[model samples]
Target: MAEEHEDPGVSLVTVDGIEGKLARVELPDGTLEDWRLASLPQGVKEGDVIRIDVRGGDVDVDHQETDRRHALGQRTLDGLNAQTPEGDLDL
Candidate 1:
């Protein structure tokens, strides 16, 4: 029986960070992969969502998806911080 999993031909990853020529990406499985900056889209920055075509080795920035994910993250943060409060304590 084939195990259930996402499509292997395509993947969506977020730009985690960039180090020199290497770009760090967070995969859907929460694993990190290092890709050459040259392989990514021009002007790629942290938090940018990328769509990778594994078979064709094509990578592109998904602006719409990025915005969606960003909004989702902001909503999550806002929801989590809405209730429980804590005062800032300077150390």
Candidate 2:
């Protein structure tokens, strides 16, 4: 019989990109891996940093980082929108 063990350490990661239903994340150690977005918490988006509890495989958002990234993204979108004409904006 094989013995099962749980990991005791948590991993900090950031959302790098999304391909279809998979979310590519960058680990604290700088390794990249893909996980199912459906398996992660709600409202996760690119550039959002999160903490993963290894034992339970639970993910929690780093609110501060998430907010910062959200603001940055909004600013970027605003800039793009400004460059775009009123009727030419795509959604």
Candidate 3:
């Protein structure tokens, strides 16, 4: 069997199709994190290299907790999009 891997950090990959100005970043562990950019920030584009930052905060691991966190993040992302004239899109 292959060895398991740990999440080193988050990694931002190239942005795919655009809609509301959101970009899909590839998480360190192969998951995707939709980053809502304010007017697609400078130097950010397709095939551009970027790093994903994870802040130190409380996180719940249980299913319910995971769902809660996910929802919270989604809400935060939505707020970010709302703040900008150009809405955020998902990948």
**CA RMSD for every model?**
5.3, 9.6, 14.9
Candidate 3 colliding pairs:
none
- Please, what are the lDDT tens digits per residue for candidate 1 over residues 1-91? 0111277788888899999999998877888889899989999999998888889988899898888878987777677666556733222
Candidate that beats the other on TM-score, 1 or 3, i.e. the better one = 1
The top-ranked prediction according to lDDT is 1
| Reference-based lDDT, residue 36, model 3 | 75
The sequence of per-residue lDDT tens digits that candidate 2 reaches over residues 5-73 is 244476667888888899998866677889999977788888877877777877888788667767887
Q: What is the TM-score of each candidate against the true structure?
A: 0.75, 0.57, 0.35
lDDT of each: 0.80, 0.74, 0.47
Highest-TM-score candidate:
1
- Name the regions of candidate 2 deviating beyond 4 angstroms: 1-8, 67-91
Better of 2 and 3 by lDDT: 2
| Candidate 3 lDDT by residue in tens digits, 1-91 | 0111244443233343344667674443455567775434454554343433345332211244234545776898888888877778564
Q: Candidate 1, 53: how far from true, in Å?
A: 1.7
